[model samples]
Target: MTHVIDPAELKRWLSDGAEIAFLDVREHGQFGEGHPFLAIPAPYSRLEIDVPRLVPRRTTRIALIDGGDGVAARAAEALRDIGYTDVSVSRDGVQGWQAAGFTLFKGVNLPSKTFGELVEHALETPHLSASELSHRLDAGETIVILDGRPLQEFHKMSIPGAICCPNGELARRFWDLDISPETPVIINCAGRTRSIIGAQTLIDIGVPNPVYALENGTQGWYLQDLPLNHGQSQTYRQIDTPPAEAVLTRAEALANKSGVERVDSRTLDGWAHDADRTVFILDVRSPQETAADPVPGAIPAPGGQLIQATDQYVGTRGARLVIVDTDGVRAPVVASWLRRLGHEAYVAARTDLPAASHADETLPLLPEVQPADLFANGEPPRLIDLRSSASFRQGHIEGAEWSIRPRLRPEPNQTVVFIADDPAVAAIAARDISAERGAAFRLAGGPQDWEQAGLRVVATPDTPADDDRIDFLFFVHDRHDGNKAAARQYLEWETGLVAQLDADERKLFRLPGIA
Candidate 1:
């Protein structure tokens, strides 16, 4: 049986310092709409796949809320089925919490976003308005603009002449620019969090250049009616040689200032053995270097991407994270950023750890039905495409319904066929669905196979069914066609998070002279 926890009781637990996973089991859209200040999104549709990564400890105390949409009860059951021992449903969910007069925040990544606002307010991080920056460029000023977003995002849209130098790359790869200290620098992203973090990274490390965040970033540029360069792809190249002596010295001092730990191989092993605390071993290096010397169990995440999308990597707050890199500059810089995000992050010393040489596992041996065979059946199976809602809407087998893995509910005599972009995701969905139904099958090569076989695909603007949950708000600009209004709302909402954060005492944002 599942236990129901009241809003007041849960709030008390948080106030009283209990270590619990306060999960909001709603779609990302619903989550972004409003949720408790500390609720981490764990969408019900992808619970089976996401829970292992988000809540690693099977024994951790977890409470699920879903605004009384019945998702919380379903998630609790799913958690128990997956061996999660201490799971409970939030009493009345988000609605009840609101009725009880607690704050419900808007937007995703509130933790990081709010911390960015706090950093700016506390540290008075400098900024350069898009209009002024644009004017400077137009007047032939030699300002160097560095886009702090990921390469893909920078490629999408950027200020003219802005080079892609993602957050941690300001330390790892900025030397390649070789510009004089007198040349003023500006950093930007689609919006606030990454740009703020990136600019602050430079400021914290005492970079000789005058670094400033492009106020409001590319969105601000668009709002100002400033021209943006699209599809431009100038990116920073990795420096294969050892970092310069000055870079290493500054990185060490910053890490010390931020209270980042420097651990060795033995310390990593000890943390790995600890049952109480969850530990994540990440190799913060460029893709090329890690590909050549991959650590056995360490997840290969570039320093910049890891800091930008931290929730994707480290699930649990307060978890121990040990970042690995050979040259030492990348790991320490990223570790310092993680420290600001309230993690017990460490930069691991260069040790002769064994690289992974094991053979990769073969694909799962699951029953496959070709598109031609599927269509030729006497009564065609009820196709259930297990891809994301967006992908399904873009194009899927005609008459197919979109569904998430492990949450499919088939009707009597209905034959369900799972399909996804990745065969692995399809296979996992097939396994879970087949366990409930007597049999399940997947498209041999997913949607691509269906298309290759000259089968018809359809597109629709319809949202997923009411029962379906949108797993993630993949982009910050994912609202109302990503228009100016949505961008403006996002920017305004972000700036206001600091004030809301002042009321909530749970956040542990440590900035210079403020700890």
Candidate 2:
């Protein structure tokens, strides 16, 4: 029989030494708009296929939640249909969790804790925040406002004088940017993750000074209504419309006539090694995808956001660039987009990849899976989770140590398993991590796959333990911060959601002053 724990009790349990799998079966928009910090989102409709591909553990407990849309039970039933043994719905699903007094977060990721890690790391390396950045700009600090968005976006609207090229090429063609690392490199996106990842990438790859995210990029700029670049928002018009076939023919002719060399992936990777050369390697993938299997030295700027956010990326006014992607298609689009903006650009090709797949999409992979107990076996490879940061932090394999910051260039020193919400991204990340560091990597069976595979997941208590192990209950004082956040975050946990994880026998840790 499944256990039903109340919101207060559940948080305590999680903070203790338990390992629990969190789920929110709400619709995509609802899930995207707001959810708990740790709950990995699996839309009620796509659970069947996506679950198995994402979660690979067989021993994890399932925490099923919903918006009380009569789908919680159905989702749980589906979990059982898919062979999940330990499943329970939120007390009243989303309603109950919310009623319990937990705060919900808004973003594409749940357990929004990992973003903190990204920020911390970026800050660690000569980074600055939006507020701090404003001071520098006002004071005339020699700075580089790089729009990590694509060229079209840069042309459409961006901070005046910011260049394009998106996040993907920050390191791929760092030398191409031709600015001293000491020049403050500030990056921005429409919102958060991309900018966070982009800024972190520069710091991780040994950029001389600090890097920063504009916090909220163009939108923030607009929300503040501070000197808008309100030209027609034709961010992609130049790149998308193209310069006609004749223009492309002319460029091809120029390449042929000038005999300029076009290098492949392996050759480009070799060229990128020289510190003297500035190569900003751009990986064209979503921030979440980049998190799962990031190109160790590559910066991410998703294809869609590239255009509008370009001005925030290109660093200085006139920077050359080399763009990369999972395959060659995205690179040229971005490269050509940059060229249209009058920035020197090219797609460094790769032979190992087919013409269709031949760009700087190269990334590292994870090590093979030896179960979460790999540590108990005495040969613990560093346990790095590919799951979204919030998901990993709110709860994950007990005792598994993780570096919240996404690896810009992963080294191949240890065995690693890539656990994520998507198998494709996990597989790719694992493969890239492996390829780069030559480390052993494997895909964590995904959420549904874990239960279907009959793997065991420890139940996460809603509380913390003295030894830092996750238990079943973290007591909510009358006026504590945890009391508020947890209440709003797991509104449904108090009702049906709480019923799933609550256990009277699973007591919580009380404070010294508690009666």
Candidate 3:
């Protein structure tokens, strides 16, 4: 039996300073449109896979919410099945929270986005409009543009000639760029948060160069009819030498100002042994560095992305975060931002920790059926394509019905065969459907296998329709797909987030001069 928690009580639980996993189990589209201020999205489609990482401690208090469609109940049952001892569902989910007179924030990464806006307002972070930068470039100005987004995002689209240097690496890699101290620097991201944060970081460090964030970032450039380069490989190179002592001192002072604590491996062990507290050990290094030599028992969370998307990495609000990095530079920089974001963040003094073991629960494998065997009898088994709706629309095995984990519906006692890109999704869905649906089998391979076997494949451009693509967030993504109105709306949304916060929500941020 599952317990029900009302909206007011759940809100109180969040602010009580205890570790709680407040998860919203709705799809991405629904989650992005509107959700509670601190709710982390753990969509029901991938509940088991995401919950373990988000809330590592199975015994932690977990509160699940949805759109009052009983999805929370289903998710609660799933978590309980996976060894989560303390689980409860929101009384009526988001609808209940609204009725109780709480704000439902629009957009994801609420805390981080709001903090970015507050930082700009408080610090008066200097910025340059896209037109201003463009004119300067045309005049042969010696300004250097640094794209503060990750390399992958930079590869997708960036200002022509911009070099990829993520915000987290800006402090450590700034000297390696070999630009003159007098040269002006401009930092940009897809939108505002990273650009502002990156620029403010340099200014705080007291660099000699003139630094300015590109206002509205790439979207601002697009609005000005500026060209963007795709597939660019320009990025900061790895340096053999360590950061300068002055740089390290400045970073450590900034971390101290934000109330960041430096802890050694023994201290981390003590925190891990505490049954009442939840501690997340995150390695705040570059992906390549972590892959080459990862710290034991640490999840790799690249610093810039982690600060930008804290809810994705750290699900348990108010929990202890131990950021690990080999260099003294990156961890402190990342921890300072995290502390201001209202998390109890600390940097690891050393990186020698014992490896933690994870539960290896296995899912029952459904029998596999070849394409020829799929239609051996007179009638074919009900073919359910569990691939993404977008992928299904691109092309799928002929006569296959598209469905997702949460929305699967099969006839009673029906023979079913699942075609999916990820076998795990199919296996989870197979375990979910009513047992009376008879035995379930997966296509030996996906649509590609069927195509290889000379089976018919079909495409339906308008099959799922825009509304049914709940897995994708069109509100945030449409701006990238050449939607001018969406781009403007998104910018407006980003600029207006700070004003939407309630008193309690606003109090979470501890910016300069704010008590």
Model 3 lDDT tens row, 124-149: 99999999999999999999999999
Which has the greatest TM-score?
3
Off by over 4 Å in 1: 15-18, 350-366, 404-413, 422-437, 446-448, 451-454, 463-482, 512-515
Q: After superposition, how far is residue 289 of candidate 2 from its true place, in Å?
A: 13
Question: Residue 80: error of model 2 in Å?
Answer: 1.8
Q: Candidate 2 on 1-515: residue-level lDDT in tens?
A: 44455666655544454445567766555665556655666655445545543332333466777766556666676567557677766776666767897656554432122332323343452344555666677898888777766565565567654555466555444444558767877776544445655575555444576577676555455444445453433221112222344434443443333233355667665654443333445566556558887665555666534433443233222223556555443455445434433344566643322222124322333344635444455775655555543355466654444332113235567666555555444554443354554454554555455545544444444323222321112322111122444333432222222222223211221112111
Q: Looking at model 1, report the run of 10 residues with the lowest lDDT sum.
A: 352-361
What lDDT does each candidate get?
0.76, 0.49, 0.87
Predicted model with the maximum lDDT: 3
Q: What number of backbone clashes does candidate 1 have, counting pairs of residues 3 or more apart or in separate chains?
A: 0
lDDT winner, 1 or 2: 1
Kindly provide the TM-score of model 2 when superposed on the true structure, using C-alpha atoms. Answer: 0.41
Candidate 2: worst 10 consecutive residues by lDDT? 505-514
Candidate 1 residue lDDT tens string, 94-209: 99989988889887777778777777767788998998998888899999999987788888888888998878678877877888989999989888777788888888777889
